[model samples]
Target: MKKKHHRVALFAATGVAALLAPAALRAQESGAIQLEQIDVSGGPAQARTAGATAEKGAVGPIDARQLLPADLQTFAGSASRVSSQDLANQRPLTTHDALRNVPGAATVSDDGYGRHSGISLRGSPFRRSRKVLVMEDGVPINFSTYLDAGTHYTPPMDRLESIDVLKGPLVNYGPLNNHGVVNFRNLSPFGPKETVFSAGVGSTEGADQRVNNTRHAHTRQTFDNVGVVLSYSGLNAGGSWDAERLGYDDFYGALGIRGDNQDLTVSGGYFRQRDRYDEDNFSGTLADFKKYRHDKKRAAEAGHFPVSCGRCYEWNTYNADYFRAQVAHNLHIDSKTTLSTRIYGNHHDRARFYVSDDSDNPPSDFVMEGRDRLYRNYGADSRIEFADLPLFGGVTHTVQAGLRYEEHFFDNKNRLGSTNERLDFGNRGSLDGKQKLTAQSFAGFAQTAIQITPTFSVVPGVRLERYKISFRDFDEPGNDGHSTYVQALPMLSFAWEVAPTTTLYGGYHRGLSPHIVRDVLDTDTGYIAPKKEIGDNLQIGVRTKAVRGLTFDGAYFHSDIRNYQFGEAFQSNLGDRVFSSLDKARFDGVELSARLDSRAFTNSPWNVYGEGVYTFVNSKIVRGTADGGVNVAGNEVPESMKHTANLTLGVEHDSGLDASLSWTYRGSFYTDALNLPMNPLDVEEGKVKGVWLLSARASYKVTKELTAWVSGQNLTNEFYVSDRSDGAKPGVGRTVMGGLTLKFH
Candidate 1:
């Protein structure tokens, strides 16, 4: 009966897609827009095609209004983009949801709102708090201290104004540049300065409510600029799964201030988030005697055993606080010299807790665990440009240099005890541990662009980096260690303006991601060893705006990775121990995207727009010590979908009414290292079929200051598996949400 219900729901969603296909095709035809000319800055016009400097007319210092109507920066490269308009339109409750449209991205959820969420990019081997880099307003958030248990926390999405994502290890001006980079650009203090407030309520597992208020004020008479934003949310409800467990609640807030002068700008902010959740354990197969009988018929036949039928409750909590400040200054030393310097500092404190079997049914055992981690980071970066140099045909050149330093401290403690003291079986004890780690690095790069002709240009560049890591454990001696590594990255590229509407470009570069505290820490000995990863990537693409209202961009890329980090499981008489290992991997893929903006009727009130993206990836493990040297060379990388696509269609009018409908689909994927067969929980074996998601939203203006909107997501009530692992169940079923917005200036 359960299988039949699942089939019925799948068929219904397919029917809806067939019904909406024609309308989507028509919308695509009416809303297409031609691509615009790209602006190149800093380096010679020819060098813009290379990685030398940003394009001149490119949208620097993003603005809110420009985010609408599709901008070139979003499509400049195969990677890197953040659409403020999309964020406003989607109003995602979590950061993971906001990144659903990015290329080569996937997310897994441990719970609602504030549970564990993990992301995989371009088939990187990192998982469960490893390898990835996250930053808040240019400040590194990862601790440099020794191996820590809890390093995977992000600020609430509501406090962020934009998110910038870079898919592979790329050299950026900051610490913690590992597998990928995600920069959370918080709301800045600028503009006319206004006060805005909003409140909302929704239904999911239960009831939810949120309120947000912000004040932006500035005084020209004073040399100081200040801004503050505060928000609060509450959730009290039942969950969709099991129907017996309750949901969780989360609260977060942020405050920011800034000051600016003719050649300098300084800003700082503070943020905090608190979360609580009820944990749910995974149920094994029915054959296992310890498994709880969720089936009603089985319970009845067994005479309703209370211990095996009752629900269990677990409690978990997380609290985090972060503060950051940065300064940027422009320097003028010579007629042809332009330079800029930036420096920043960041500090964070985090605490987490977990409690199992809170009710202690059947006098079962209960356990509690907690951890605290603190981190501090500092960095300084500068870029200089020298134009019309006589060294090479009077070509232009740019030099970039930077230095970064970080300090981290991790203190972990765990205690276990039974619900009843009489049942204490020698398992009740406490363990305390502490570790410290530090990282320091310096980098220098130089690139020059040569203009050979009016229509063609070439640029070449190279960068050198030196990194050092040191670790020490206060609780254990003989665990102190230090390691250092140096690397050089070179890049070259060329661009040709073949026609007024066509541009052809290509480039090749080297990248690296260094191992940190987590890579070296031995769970038993509390000792760690440093590891490093290096890779090279090649890319070629063509961008065109041939038609009057249609623009397209496509790219092909291949990356070779050496010394990749992986986890290995070992069994001992004491227990099972998992340690980090080194392996080699490779990733290759293609991506294509297009946007169309058009007006069907010159005088009509209806205007249509459409945007779409398609990605194809093939990632594999080339060499590894396990598997008897049998290469799993052709298998698709774990968690990376073979193909993914999204399409959006909308209509707008001059009268302040806008409506849009969107569809997204993700291909089947694997979830484990071995890609084993015959396992129901194996993502690669069960093969979660592709799903079509449909959402529609519309807005109506009540007055100049207020506007109300009604939106529905997953209207077809599609039951799809967003993520799955060895023993974890997929995400919840269909969800529906609505909201309203107001402006006061």
Candidate 2:
């Protein structure tokens, strides 16, 4: 083994010398000239001759091009961008993998697949990602952005070109931006014409086996001034847990028309998913979990508990369909002025049929519960931007203002039936409960960038929002109610260039999250209402490229939340949770991100690169009472981990050989505001232990048009508890996969 290691090192050194010798000699013969920086935003700025709007209105306000590693100092706030090249190099199996290394972002709910998991930002709670604003192509994607705000669907990874994470004082994309925003950018239809296909398959090695398959195709073309794009992605897999099956397919299309001074784009897509997974059997008591971690079906047998027999447990299933459409138009009215508008609509239908045995006693008959839900949403936004306008005393200003209107409706129904019945359409049980919610909102915002001097700028903005929501409970007519609210939120941010490659930036904003329909008027108590969340957020950060081949970004943030909300689960049953609020809560933290590349220092064929992110948060409930009227003051906030970190190190050669090894760590946190210790029953109110995972991937370009790759996750085969929403649940075990890609023009 020692001799083999030495030989490998010698071979790498020889290859590096052979590839760098000519470049080194050329630099000596003539003065070295660096290449011009490439714009990485992949937005209109790259494809259009007219100067694109800095904040491109409804399409997206933040420009990702300023987030390049070498140009981080140009951005005015804490932000990061994962480019198309980064995604191709990572080849992530789930969205968690793709976002693991981003500062201030955390994935708490894995769900084995990335489809419906939670993505938390900063100090927000990670359950269902309720506190973060998620967008795709600059449009909201939550189940009901104004009524429910629970994310249930996400676009497939194969169809995306990049992801942008913007943190701190989000004044342009509100209503739910208490923490920050995450935007998923689709591949532009205006890019070069090409066709690409990808296929892969793999399996896990363990007591419970899981098989995986993936296929995707994308095509783009243009004729004269018209451009078109079509894409599809499909997945079939045996999920992480036993007796679990998952499958989904996504289809998208886009058409673009470009004229001398204006452009129009129309895009739409459909996504369908079906999965057979026993929701009740996914978790169990602590003793049962430790003894039979992988044997979810047989866990109850250990305690001599009568368990649901063979087919009874397999009745649980989930089905969902999403239909979306949007139109965006940009008009260059003049050299320094532009107007943009976006209109979008979507319809989502989802149903879950799960076997339930929630009786307190040991023996009970299994019953099927069907939860059906539907949502419809429509919105239109328009904005105008004026750039480089002279105001007074040699001061220039860039101003942007917009107006938005939105309407949303949600319908939910619950039904119960015997397990022996044939659940054909999953909506066939007797109606037991029903609810309907509707909301309409109107908002306006204006922000101006005042260039006080050449090296410093100050941005001031304010948003006025008004919304009305109504809720109706069919089973209980007394629970019907309606409410209206209006808010004026203001923000201020500044950026100062202290050096050629260093920037100091900070901001302050007022954040708000309106009460959901159910929370606005609690059905459990006809007239009891929970207050909405209001927070005062402050942040300061620095970005520097002082080192030759390294870029570093660090920030400190603090948030004071009034009427902070949290949820608690029942100890004895599943699907029984309650939401409550505290008078005041506080969260303060620091986030650090750094990246290093050897290629930045020298023109070497074999380059080494490393990147990492670390976060530290201190959260506390200043004033609150538990369900039993216990004072919970000074206790740590639930689901707020104190520490989390991720690191990746890799090597790339000009020959198209790339490999990377990553390590991710998630710190321990409590499940309730009381910060209760572990109990034998293994209920949700307890401390969850921390865990670390290791993953490795390598890919080689066999030819110009073809590439091959393989990856392994959880390489240590670590068996650990992932989450405790209902009870202790096991994380994904070790898995390996390999794949190939083909591209042509």
lDDT of each: 0.48, 0.71
Give the TM-scores of the predictions, in the order they appear.
0.74, 0.89
Each prediction's total of clashing residue pairs, residues at least 3 apart in sequence or on different chains, is 19, 0
Clashes of 1: 19
Candidate 2 local lDDT, 1-745, one digit each (tens): 3453344334333432332211100000111111122233643342311123332211123222111222345555677777778888998887777888888888864455667657878867777777877888778888776788877677888888777787756577777777887878776666677788999888654323356888999997778767788999998765545555677899999887766545567899999888765445334456666676556556544431224443444456778889998877655555555566667789999888866554233234556678888998877777666666778997877777777778888988887776445343545588879999888888888887777876787888898888887888898888987778888889888878889778888888888877556655655778444466888989999888988999888999999988888766444432455576878889999999998999998888999999899988898999998777889999988878888899999999999999999998877887778888866565334887788889999999999999998988788978776766655656767777889989887
Per-residue C-alpha lDDT of model 1 across residues 1-745, encoded as one tens digit per residue: 3453344334333432332211000011111111122234565554322111322311111111111123332222335456556666555655666766665554444444423445555545323434455566555555542233224455555445667665422343322333356666654433333344444444442212222122222221112343333333333322223322322233333333332211344656555544543222232332431232222223322422212322222234455566766664443344334444556566666555444333344335545545555676555555554444444555443333333333333433334434533211123234446666666566666655445454455556666777676777676657777777788877665556577666676666676666545446665765656666777767777777876667777777777777665443221111222333337677787777777867732557767888776777687767654334445555545555666677778777777777877786666665434554424432213334457777677776677766666655556755444444323233443445455566566
Cα shift from native, residue 439, model 2 (Å): 0.6
Model 2 TM-score, 2 decimals = 0.89
Candidate 2: list runs displaced more than 4 Å. 1-72, 205-210, 281-287, 300-307, 358-366, 424-427, 519-525, 573-575, 680-684
The per-prediction CA RMSD against the true structure, in angstroms, equals 13.0, 12.2
Superposing every Cα of model 1 onto the true structure, what RMSD results? 13.0
